[model samples]
Target: MSDSVPMTPECYARLQEELKNRIKVDRPKVVQDIAEARSHGDLSENAEYDAAKDRQAHIEGRIAELNDKLARAEVIDPKSINTDKIVFGATVTLFDTDSDNEVVYQIVGEDEADIKQGKISVTSPVGKALIGHTLDDEVRINVPSGTRIYEVTEIEYK
Candidate 1:
């Protein structure tokens, strides 16, 4: 089963920008590098040619991956989301039960998850458990670190 990728407007824009950069700038550079490497005599002993070929393959793979993701992306504007409960693109503030400290996390797409930035993927254990939950609700998530619980103190769409 394929999962839908819910992306913020900014995330969608970033994906489009990445696709443009790969196709217009990086692809041409790789092709040129490969051509230059090809001019260096025997293909069997040419390290430059092999490296260039490898780089080309990597670039192609990334382009395809980005393209597929963009095609399947479902862009959602945070400002348009309802503010009653936690949802995609909602910024949630929670108090960790174990640590007794406040933590903020923005529920985002899987591709946009960055723990250091406090963006959690919607498919993540905590994010999944938090979805549709209202303020003051306790959420229990089973992570690799075992069971963890957090109290939702606030939910904001902006």
Candidate 2:
């Protein structure tokens, strides 16, 4: 069976854009570099040629990876989700009982996870605990710091 990775529509679009750039712009640039290095003479002592080849290999590997991910991507759109309980793509607001803090987080795909942007991966500890939870529900999570309790304050999809 083939493996499929879940991704938000925005993340899937970003991957497509990167793949297009790699094929259209970066690929040709690497080819031109290799050609230029080859014209510089003896291959036995051609450091430039060796470097170009290494770069070419790296670029090709990235292209292959991007293509594979795009081929197996499952795009989940936030706008189409309608659920009262927390699930993938749900933006949840929680009131931390520990430090008396309120924070917002959106459960997103692993590729789209960025703590600075308030997007957490579904497999993360906090995200996993929030799954299937509803507003006004209390959730307990164990972190490296310690165990803490949080009350689900809100849930929105956008």
Against the true structure, candidate 1 has what lDDT? 0.91
Stretch of 10 with least lDDT, candidate 2: 1-10
* Model 2 lDDT tens row, 74-116: 8988878999999999999999998899999999988899999
Please name the candidate that would achieve the greatest TM-score relative to the true structure. 1
Instruction: Give the local distance difference test score of model 2.
Output: 0.93
Candidate 1 has which clashing residue pairs, if any?
none
Once model 1 is optimally superposed onto the true structure by TM-score, how far is the C-alpha of residue 12 displaced, in angstroms? 0.7
Model 2: residues >4 Å from true position, as ranges? none
